[model samples]
Target: MTLSRLACLLLAAAPLALSAPARAQAQGQPQGQASPAPGRTLRVAPHADLRTLDPVFASIVITRMHGLMIYETLFAWDSKLRPHPQMVESFSTSEDGLTWSFRLREGLRFHDGQPVTARDVIASLKRWMGRDTVGGKLAEYTAALEASDDRGFSLKLKRPTGMVPFALGSAVGQIPAIMRESDAATDPMKPVTDTIGSGPFRFNRAEWRSGARVVYDRNADYRPRAEPADGLAGGRVVKLDRVEWVIMPDPATAAAALQTGEIDIWEQPGQDLIPVIGRSREVRVERYSSLPNQAMLRPNHLYPPFNDPRARLALAYATDQADFLAAGFGDERWWKRCGSYFVCGGPNGTEAGAAGYAKPDLDTARRLLAESGYKGETLVLTSSYDIAHIGRMAEVAGEALRKIGMNVDVQFADWGTVTTRQANRGPVDQGGWNLFVTTASGATMQSPITNIGTNMACARAWAGWPCDEEAERLRNAVAEARDEAGRMAATEALHRRLAEMQPYRVLGQYDQPYARRANISGVLEAPVMVFWNIEKR
Candidate 1:
């Protein structure tokens, strides 16, 4: 069935009046605001349903976007990728650089009308450190973290490094979101249901539906910085009174809604549908970032076959990046075949040790599979059917692996279910997965230290537990390098080591353009979609 025909059928079957937005509005609005003005409400059709509210518990983009609406960080990356203070009023370091003192900005209040104190920040950082890759590295150097007073805190480091502020302000996976002390005290592994923050928007928990819609209202009490708005930094001035995220998993339905002006913005329009959608004068397709989003095929290191380095290497040798990129993104103009794990066009982009596996070698793959002692065990490849590109990537990879003479089982489900199953560390027969497809922002993939795929913290690492002491050593060397020259050299060495370790395979890099109504303005060019500063006409 053609996508355009599928879109027409879906739209005809479920009319817009009885769609998710209508059902969502019937539920309820925020406490004080009985009804929002027409232009004050910005309706957005997000790529996926926001099932998980806690960004720390899940590293997915939907949860991260949800968190950004309600939460504020101490520091954030600017347009130039430089760290700038957001919540911190003042900070200082001792001569030895071991003792760091920070004071919270005054008048910072949570949605529940409570003051944001240093104790809350301390607790939030502690909880985040347990799960986030960058936070874990920061935890390694921390000697003690304590609240000096109600609005002040101090971090004492065992040994000084330059990753303190960067770790706190990282806009990558599992951002260190500041929450109330009570809420931050929740177990790191568990989800925090309470949504109280000092950011520009407040999460409307009463109006939130699992698969239908998620809503946020302007935080009337939020204080903007003196500086003008920048990328994920500067003043977060909320222009719209309310932002509604209507969950539309089907691309055709979303495109139809977007064309009809039912939704103000479509976060991710399918690449194949861009040409059709772009023809409308009312809609405009805009590229959010210059850096492309990189696709990855991650294998489980805890299970057999992939547990062996040779088996992992075999998969890398057998598969071609062009196949994944072409299957995932149809337009050649939008996608690039890149071998660099750090992103091809970025500053640290290098294909140092990827030459041997640059193109597919079936003979080498077969030899490696035999040497790894694989007994044709069924390898379960889990993926989400809700996401079109990722689903296509999974199918392409599964077929490629089967051609290399391995028993492969492809499983498809909703994104939320796939993520839940991905968390299971048990065997494949026991609801565990051997492989999964995911993506990371190019902004996060530029540095070896910030990229979660390069993390080798064993049990503490990201989903697939890959442990290598030498890789960790080389990564630290890159982080601790004195100069840019030294850093690049260390990065190349680490890249070489990563190629041998085979933690994850980088499929390719591609641009993800956002489709928005022509009247909507002030959409900031950021790594992720943010609600603040966007105004609907």
Candidate 2:
């Protein structure tokens, strides 16, 4: 699992370099699909394989996009960033604001041909609330979740919580996707076999070949709302009859395929290859997401040396955000130095807590490490080199840490294996990991209320599991604030506490550009990539 061994493995696993003619012939087009059918079938090369099928288990970008395609939510955020009714026909709260009632639109049917019901909605929300960091917090304020009728449900809260609708409609990772009661009853930690959803598209499970390809067919029975498509809200019209997600690990091959018109869209193209794509007359390179991705370095709180706050602070000081930004995004134009726990330029984004860890302070870092304890233990730096940015960031971090006289062990693997390994909480010598690098969409870090990385509740927090009582209290304060200003003030305080805790380090922000052929149209500019309104001309 060392870096050199990992490189050898990658070379062995990658598709061999082939001649242009051979490469073209290898992409066996679907039978009778030689001619472009415009809205019939759209071929795409996603950034990575769809590893986790259950949206509730993993919050990665690809999984979220898959969730958006196959499942429907009661509410959705509009272009104005306001919560709007999607599946919900109407909703209201009692005068006390403690009781909220909701009714779903009529004729909603699952991919399995079963009618959607309120009992399903109640069970689905209950299961989602138990897994999502924000939903778990919101659940603390709820007294009960009950179904009022076949098409309606009611939520009775212990106090006035205005975030109920927003929580259900959150655009962040792991959305509360509506599902049948039978499917929703699966254990939160386990994956469900049922892919049945009532969304605009249905998952073509028969064609899903784990690391190779995945397919989705249009749900003709779906009835879109009257409103026009806007963001993830409004009408979700499935213009393409079939959406094929072909996994190509090699960026050059993906770019070449896009150039040859074998692929309609490349969800994530390496920055260095943008020019190559632009040179192709038929291909167009553009920034696909509304929010820049937030890169992060997470340390395991269960094991040493990061278990100690001073040790975590030392590592944070030794690392430089600019180095990671430059390594991941070569050009200064695509990336920016961000010094905030929350996303910069957003409503709750602030630098209130980013004081000393903005730049590299190797001297201070060494001194702090010495002060914590002189014992030299190897710090495991787990990295997923499959992702170009993540791998570059890890190399930069490893170099920085070595300079500060720390023993470092750099282990490299694919992103899927890295994410799965991060959950192990044992000692590093056994099966646990000390540190890892990853990125989150800005949508996930906008506020303490929706941020999963900031969750500090003991045993119930996300992967890294850094528990800080002060940070937890401040997060609750942010959630309970009555006005926008109050919420902002509380958020700033929470950010300051997080800065002190050093649970995780925010490296920087970079745009992930997507490349597509000119014939494709109606690609929505959203935080999560969507395929509903897109067409192949």
Candidate 3:
């Protein structure tokens, strides 16, 4: 899943105090050492590489989850995606809902043994929203967020945005620990050095060139909430004194490591291995679908052909989700023909989508394409060339669309570039191609709070193509609504518009498969992986 982290953040680790490590588990030897130690280092062979270790910027799968043990979030969501307050004790907002005041739990400290203060929180957030820094989501609505004192902080928004705190659940809202904004302004974070954060584990070293495997050790000053991270994650402690995040590009290799007991955990398992891996009594498959945010196929609304609803609808109509799902994924398991912008149980959850979204009707698709003014012109689909499966899925989706009469052309490229191009796309102003696939994932979020105006209406053209004026207006209403109910209604209304418009053909969610030894315990399963909530068997 892709994660966006605000830069110049905090990370974990404390070499100041060290007691002999205790075995996190009573049953077996420590994860990596011959003699068990509570702080003993554990090794892991994961499917994806760690993107970065900059506390404010590294929000990728391995990095963010690993960082959780190092950095802390104001709030966390459990397996059921429920909120669990962490750093802040109890929080409240002004009547206008534009000013949020947070009362933090006292006596909290960073891994460095530094007292966590309102000053620190204020510093971290301001730096995050200051620019296009990493680990930031509230850059738009935020006008000022300051520390009233050591134990209190207040945030003033440009307008009433209900999703404010909820946005904190995202990767940006999650990391780099805390740092003074003044300090960062003078010496900005570098892409080369490892970052800092406040979590159970602290950064040891990050050598991305070493295959993206990062090593971290328990923070000597670290502490855990006796309460579980969520209902899905029961009581847990930072198990295995140390952690070795080994990079294994091949899913098969990672799976083999799990079978051989070379690695105690596997974060992402290949789709083909899902069925067979679960069959092994030696290993258990914890199916983690929707691990990332929803995977959306956004429209290239700026271009000529896509500027018309008939053309956009034709593309949607031409899409054979069944074939695409089957080719990209062996099973029809995780893929959802969703009508709304969110998942079934997300903040925007409702029964509205079930009645609206369904499988394709080729006859209708063919008719739409015909009416959309297509003289069998070649349509290009831009996608990620890496991640073997997604590249394959893009190809399969391209082919499937052709069956319904789309002169589909597939372009494999980095997703970042593709998404930007697609969002700003419009009209027949000639370019290398047409239609780019955009994907969003990593954490659950409330839209009215997280997304900005630039991202609201297909690159701000609100009137043309699949995104109509109603969506634009509703987005505005959702942003300005003073009450939660009003904002939610607006959010739902806009989501409904997305379904009705069917901007891009929905692909599906990225489901992650986690595997652990039979005796292992404390598996924190949720959209985001919280490693501190894990313990050895």
Q: State each model's CA lDDT, in order.
A: 0.87, 0.82, 0.55
TM-score of 2: 0.93
Write candidate 2's Cα lDDT for 1-537 as tens digits. Answer: 243553454344334333434433444434444433545889899987887877876777788899999998888877545678989999999999999999999999998888999999988888888878867888889999988789988999998878887888887767889989998987887876678889999898876777667889888899999998888889999888899887788776776667767679999887766765677789888875666778888888887777788888887788878899888877788899887767888787798867777878889999888887737888888997667878989998889888988888889988788877887778876778988888887777876877778898867788888988898899988889999899988998998888888878888888888898999988877767899888777
Worst 10-residue lDDT window, candidate 1? 23-32
Model 1 misplaced regions, further than 4 Å: 1-34
lDDT of 1 by residue, 356-425 (tens): 9988999999999989999898999999878899999999999999999989898999999998897899
Q: What TM-score should be assigned to candidate 1?
A: 0.96
Candidate ordering by TM-score (highest first):
1, 2, 3
Q: Whole-model lDDT for model 3 versus the true structure?
A: 0.55
Superior by lDDT: candidate 1 or candidate 3 = 1
Model 3 TM-score, 2 decimals: 0.73
lDDT of 3 by residue, 1-537 (tens): 211110101001111011123212321234555533523546566544555544453323444465565666677656655555677787898897789888777767765556878877776665555322222335557888788888888889887766655555444322434543333333333322434555667776532234435667766666666674563233336766677776655565555556656567776665666664576688887755344334444455655566666766666665655555555556657455443455445565543432423666778878877786777877777776435556667777677678877787787764434433443334434444475543444343324343321133432221123445676677667767778798788777776665556556555554556787675666655655555656666
* Clash list (residue pairs), candidate 2: none
User: What are the TM-scores, per candidate, against the unseen true structure?
Assistant: 0.96, 0.93, 0.73
The candidate maximizing lDDT is 1
* lDDT, candidate 2, at 111: 86
lDDT of 2 at 128: 86
